[model samples]
Target: MTSPSTATLHPIGRSTPGTEWWRTAVIYQIYPRSFADSNGDGLGDLPGITAHLDDLAALGVDALWLSPFYPSPQKDAGYDVADYCDVDPLFGTLADFDVLQAEAHARGIRVIVDLVPNHSSDRHAWFQRALAAEPGSAERARYLFRDGKGDGGQLPPNNWESVFGGPAWTRTTNADGTLGQWYLHLFDTSQPDFDWANPEVQEEFRRILRFWLDRGVDGFRVDVAHGLVKTDGLPDHLPAVDGDSMGGDSDDVPYWGQDGVHEIYRDWNRVLAEYAGDRALCAEAWLPTVDRTALWVRPDEMHQAFNFPYLQTEWDAAHLREVISESLRAFPAVGAPATWVLSNHDVVRHTSRLALTAENPQGHGIGPDSPGQPIPEVGLARARAATAVMLSLPGSAYLFQGEELGLPEVIDLPGDARQDPTWFRTDGERYGRDGCRVPIPWQADAPAYGFSPSGATWLPQPAEWATLARDVQEADEDSTLWLYRTLLATRRAYALGSGDLEWLEGFGTDVLALRNGPVTVIANTGDAPVALPAALESATLLIASTPFAGTAVPADTTVWLLAG
Candidate 1:
């Protein structure tokens, strides 16, 4: 392994005329409330993000995808959107968002805003009006409001479980103080799911898309993309496994990946295609297979869907190779580029998750409070290696905020400090996602790690965060931040995005070697260093997760070589 060299960096990828920038673009995911707080109000806002645009541009990302900043009571953070068109006062005004977009675009970075079409906050005016209206009123028809199963409407409409926990249906009280209709909420009770069967619901989202597109957004990252349409009759479905788990393979999982959802995207796709600048839609759909996931990105559907299987695969060479091959083969059939991601606001940070035992691979809700979890140091090594491999692969890559600095899950937040509904809903059996949502550390010595001047953060930062602060990492060439910067820069230099991936042979089961364009990416997933195969031994090393001294690729490290 060798240290990254000081090479003048190029942009994420070179754009030719009529080329779709998103096919190989590197998009950074910004969880608004935790990214940067410019108002000193203890929350990250649009202006805060605007203040940091230069830093993001320097990071070499091609676009910025902001998680919802919409008006909300925040029962599920910003996912419970109260107003689709307005910004939450806590985050800033709509005017602030425009400035953020302008600033990001000015720096040659595109902006993709989150669109939560599957549901809306119970506090949304439409949902409120539904509560005031009669059971069959037009206002109540916008969402999934149904009669309960039992007499007197005491029981829930069905046995469907919420993704957060508990029953998916919640009984609402009418203005007269009597128990009213039960509405469906796949997530938190505050997030009422929409009835996609309604024409008004479908048209409302079209208007919303035009509203944001008219405002100059480059694209949208669709939340719960597969969940727009449900099975007819809202049938009762109880899987043999934990029904609440995401990305199930069973077709019996009633609410996910229904055939009708494709038609909705096809309609949405037409609206996006009407706009200039290739305004794309990236689906957050968690389907079962690479082939199935590719359907969301078919010719008339979304442009890209998040590759959760790649993100969820255990740290193994053969498993990774198979996923890469499948994803590459499947997406090209639809003429869409695959999207890669590691950490996100909803899951446990990869660095922390990879440190855990392989049997429980996903880091979704794990935190410091979880007993017997492995230390962060062990995971940081593999995380660095894994990121190098992911960035080198053919596709667009989504980077979670602070992942460049090797931030781990802040698992130690006090019980009362937690806000994720999963904790309360599951009766503390699950710790929830508050740990990974901790504000990113920027300045090592600054209060609240420089996330806000007021030193107020919605989630507490661990003391070890000071060592992993961006400022500290920026000054160190061997830092994880440097690795990411170098990797992105190198990936661009080689123009390896959306290319054929040919797997190289003669490597151990723990070693993965592949060629894309003129560059070869090799990874050592085992505990011991491995010698490079005959073809790569003489190749020039471009960048590596660790310092290279000889022909050996280090344990848990990935290296890129210039093809011979």
Candidate 2:
């Protein structure tokens, strides 16, 4: 095959070139609760993270994106912040966090904490003070409050639905047995949404950002960044379906590109620009279209927003190519780089999403449920292809923990074991995320699979995961972990961090190819061997997901070719 040509891929933001290191970096997300445990409390902590810096360094990632470690009531796995600046006692002390940060930086791995600005725990001091109506209190403006009519009228200030499967507003009772003011929570009722429209709220959050940055944090992964702004009038939302009301109390809808969100991000970016060269901001944007997603990265806004289309879209070569192409093309116009993620804390793993078949694996045309067998060989192949495509693409990539090792989805959780709030809704029609959020399997033979010292872990480790633990795969060159390490190291070495992508024409539906300089990665997703292009015949193989049968590429294999 012809050696893939290197083309100039423009940066997305107005920051000077090389100033924003995150643009071309690979970020590894660590869900602290499931990462590792130090005190054997069945929970992972900062010190545990400190112990794993070497593993992350070995993975060759440029930065680490920790999910949430702040003080919380454990309602949403630490997403409900009780205190922004302090570390949760369940996780560890601030001193331990400092040590973790220091160790990570020493290993050249930048740390980015998840900052949940959309809401706070109802028990938060600000919310508590607002409840008592303290005079001249700044906390009163921290959240939205509205008067209620005692004549059986219980309307909220606005109509917004909580993301956790219910109405967003919750009414509080007054001391006189009448309905008092109501509070808005876009997610859980206990987690009240913040009033970002207030100038004081803006300044306080900005100060919070600075608080961490001054203490040596490299950046922040903003939570629900777009949800910061609400509609000005707080009008009842247009009903989508009959009986589909916001919390069964009102018809308020809460999301979808609310007004004033861009300006908020722009202002936040300006504050971040002061620390520009080394730090960055990654937004969690969930928009309907690629153009809308690009809007968040416009020059003075977020450096990069999560491109969720790929995570939620169907699996296919053609569809994947179209999404990648659109995202890449749209980014440069608005001065924001494209970011790719296959899995995160909120979604199922790719292995579960794209079920692979041993017979007909690899390629864009493969069906989502092709892999029905319990053995994950085909799923492993698909995961490898995903990594190859993600890293080879032009922008930044995010790798969820254990994903590098081809971890499959946890589908069978006992009813009582389920932790996700959504599972309890409607007789458990949804399986809840407790399965995917189980403890990481560190050692196959160790108790609790090396997730904790206790005999039992917080969640049962998939019995099938015993054969695929870190210790088991670390020694096997054909293991998924090995493939990930090699791919990550290669990308870092070749400056493949960012580049222009050229999709080869005439490739079969199951095959996808990307050219980034002198390297071309051809992934075969079918059951039969694919003929290598004449130009690639002279190329040397760097890695392959499956054994090569003669010169032609075997099915379910990723062939990395470099011109000789």
Question: What's each prediction's TM-score?
Answer: 0.95, 0.89
| Candidate 1 lDDT score at position 68 | 95
TM-score of 2: 0.89
Clash totals, every prediction: 7, 15
Q: Show model 2 residue runs off by greater than 4 Å.
A: 1-19, 134-139, 147-151, 155-159, 238-254, 356-375, 425-427, 526-528
What digit string (tens of lDDT, one per residue) describes model 2 on residues 1-564? 111222212223445664467888899999999988887888888887888788888889988999889999988889899999999998899999887887777767788999999889998988988877742456667897665434554666555555555566888776676667777787778788888889988898899988987777878998887677777767666434322111112222355467588888888887876663356789887665677778888887888888876655545677888888889889867876788898887766777656633332111111223234334666667777777778877778899999987888676656787666655542454454565577788889987788777745667677887988899999998888998899988887677766667778767887777888767888777777789888788788877766765378777677777877
Model 1: lowest-lDDT 10 consecutive positions = 1-10
Roughly what TM-score does model 1 have, to 2 decimal places?
0.95
Write down the lDDT that model 2 would get: 0.74
Which one is best on lDDT? 1
Q: In terms of TM-score, which candidate is strongest? A: 1
